[model samples]
Target: MKQLIIILFLVVIGCRNETKSDEEIDETVYDMWGDFTQVHPEFKKDELPESWYFHDNKEDANRLADLVMKGKKKASSGLYLWYKEANADLPKAGTKSIITNFDGTAQAIIKITKVDTIPFNQISKEYAAMDMGTNIEPLKKWKKAHWDFFANTMKQGGNEPTEKILVVCERFETIWPKKQ
Candidate 1:
C-alpha cells in the first residue's frame, strides 16, 4: 500500500539521520582541533597541541578552566618535584596547548608567555596575584590553596612538602576562541 511505503521511507530517513549525528559526535574533538589549526597556521596539521584539563578533579578542573576562558586566570604553578617524579616535560615559553573542560571538551588554547622556577616560600605577592582565580586576598589565598595542592602532589610523588620546594610558575595568554 502507498501508506505503508511512505512509512517505511520515513523510518529509513530517520535512521540515516541518526547515523549521521552519531558520526559527527565521534569526530567532534578531532574536528575542533582541525578547526583551530585552520585558523592558526603556525600549528602543524599533523601535530595536535597538548590537551589537558586545569586540575585533578572534575569540579576544580572545570572551575579553573572556566577562569582561564574568562581571562581571570593568567598563570598557574606546579611542583617541580612532581614533574621530575613523573618524568613529565615542563611547559615552555612560546608553546601552545589546548585547555579542556573536565570532561575533555576543548575550551580554549593558551600560549605560554613566561616560565619561572622559584622556591615556594619565595613566591612573590605580585606573582600570586597574577595567578588568582578571584580578586580577593591574592597572596593569602594563593599560598593556602597552592600549599595544600602541592602537599598532596608531593605525597603522591613520594616526597614530603617543604617550604623550599621549587615551584614552576607558568604564565600564559589565551590565544584561541578569542573573547567576544
Candidate 2:
C-alpha cells in the first residue's frame, strides 16, 4: 500500500512539473469580439476566431463573399503597400479568416491554403481568374483595373507606384457558413 501511494504521488508530481510555460500558454490566448453574439446569435464567447476582411465595395465584396462561401473562388490579391500602411498582419496557410460585407456583416469563414508576394506585372492569369470569381476575365482588363486602383491608393498614401509594384496573393478555402 505504501509503495503504491509513493508511486501515485510521484506520478502526480511529474505531471504537475510538465505544466506549460508562459509563452506556450500565451499562444493559446486570443482576443474575441465581445459583442459578437449580438451580430451572430450562435457565436460562443470562448471561441477564438480568425481575422476578418471587408475586401471591397458593396457589389464586388458581396460577389467575392458569395464566391468564397460557394467555393467558387480560391484566391485574392492586394497591394502590399496598402497592407503595410495599415499594419495588417499577413495571412498564412491553415489560418482561418472571415469575410465581411460593406456594412460589416459577417459572410463566411475561409481557411488560407496558400500565400505569396508577387509583382503586379508578374501576376498569373490563374490568380486574376480566381480574383474575378466569375467567368475568366482577360488579363488585360484585370491589369488595367488593378493598376488604376493601386496607383490611386498609393497616391492617397503619399506614395507612387513604380513600374512594378508588389502584391500579396493568397489562396483560400471556404471553411464555414456553408450553403445549405
Model 1 stretches with alpha carbons more than 4 Å out: 1-28, 178-180
Q: Write candidate 2's Cα lDDT for 1-180 as tens digits.
A: 444433322222101112234443322122223333345566664355533343435676666667777777777666665555545566578766556544445566666789888988898877777765655564666688667766765665557787588887878777565324
TM-scores for all candidates: the values are: 0.76, 0.65
Clashing pairs in 1: none
- How does each model score on lDDT? 0.68, 0.58
- Model 1: per-residue Cα lDDT over 33-142, one tens digit each: 78778876767555566566665567877877788888888887876665554455777899877677666676778889999889999998888877876768888998
Task: Give candidate 2's TM-score.
Answer: 0.65
Q: Pick the candidate with the highest TM-score.
A: 1
Instruction: Report how far residue 158 has shifted in candidate 1, in Å.
Output: 3.7
Error of 1 at 143 (Å): 1.0
